[model samples]
Target: MNPLEIGSMVKARYKTGAYIGRIKEERGKFYLVEVLAVLKHPQQGDLHNPKETEGVFFHERRALAHHEKANIPKSAVSAFTDDIPDYPASLRTALQQLREDLNGQPASAYRDLALSNMDSLEKDYFG
Candidate 1:
């Protein structure tokens, strides 16, 4: 596809998760994406010190709120050919998927903490 232009619907990878957004602007090799829907929320915990709970500041990663903007790399942005889902519904689906994926894993502090973080985010997002 041609280079994504401003206002193009796109799937973008910010850090650990993916999102659906519209290209709001271009900055060098990155796209300033206005978040429309979340595909996957970022994994919880210290990204810089992955899986290191001891003495590490475990983070509560939250999905970008509806209409929030993030700078995503050009290489990480791709055309989203499918029709966009409404933001609230899309977030619900993404969170459910994350919960299922987390529950399928072996029990660990990280998993439990992640689930807790997800719960907090859900309450904030939906309340």
Candidate 2:
């Protein structure tokens, strides 16, 4: 793969979320990216524990704000050629998708916990 140039738009996985952003700088094995839109909302609940609800801290993970910068590993970044969606619209879509995916599953504590966290996140996002 060709090395990505600085200022190029990219699709990147940063932690538990995916984002569309522009590469700001390349540092060793990482690229500094400026978030333009969210492709997926960050997963809630303890990262290490994943879907567990018992004996673990449930958490809220917000999508990166527009223009927010994060250092993402090179392997997680790829060129994004499509038109960038508006941050608000993209975030709402991602959140709705996650909620729907959870809703599709048979009811479980993990699903319930994730849905509950999404509810709070939605409230905070819009209000």
Candidate 3:
């Protein structure tokens, strides 16, 4: 299987055909891709997370090369939230865990993104 790089768009083999999206995070065995579109209507739970995971992680074996044969329109595969920056899966998961450790309260979007630097930044800016 070809290795998928972060930010690279790929065609993932689905039951009926293929779904196209960008590779967001590469886990050891799977890639957390952001689905841009599918060949047909999505079945129930086809989307991993409507708010978080725009696409599901298909196995590396199921990933196909993105090409003209895919016939996915650029417009279909390019919708992304501009305000939220992409974070590595591990980092995001860790941050979520840290949030849990602290309390159940959700951090603001900016604070969430900067959690890794919270301690140092807090003294300089927050104080």
lDDT of 1 at 33: 98
lDDT of 3 by residue, 88-119 (tens): 33223333454354344466533333343434
* Model 2: residues with Cα > 4 Å off, grouped in runs: none
Clashing pairs in 3: none
Angstrom error of the Cα, residue 42, model 2: value is: 1.4
Alpha-carbon lDDT, every model? 0.91, 0.93, 0.40
Q: Give per-residue CA lDDT, model 1, range 1-127, as digits (tens).
A: 5878999999999888899999999999899999999899788899898766789899998888899999889999999989889999998999999899899989988888889988999899889
Residue 46 C-alpha lDDT in model 2: 91
User: How much does candidate 1 score in TM-score?
Assistant: 0.95
Evaluated with lDDT, which candidate comes out highest? 2
Off by over 4 Å in 1: none
Residue-by-residue lDDT tens digits, candidate 2, 25-94: 9999999999999999898889999988899988887889989999999999999999999999999999
The candidate, 1 or 2, that scores higher on lDDT is 2
Worst 10 residues of 1 by lDDT: 47-56
Among these predictions, the greatest TM-score belongs to: 2
The C-alpha stretches of model 3 lying farther than 4 A from their native spots are 15-17, 40-127
In Å, residue 110's CA in model 3 sits off its true spot by 50
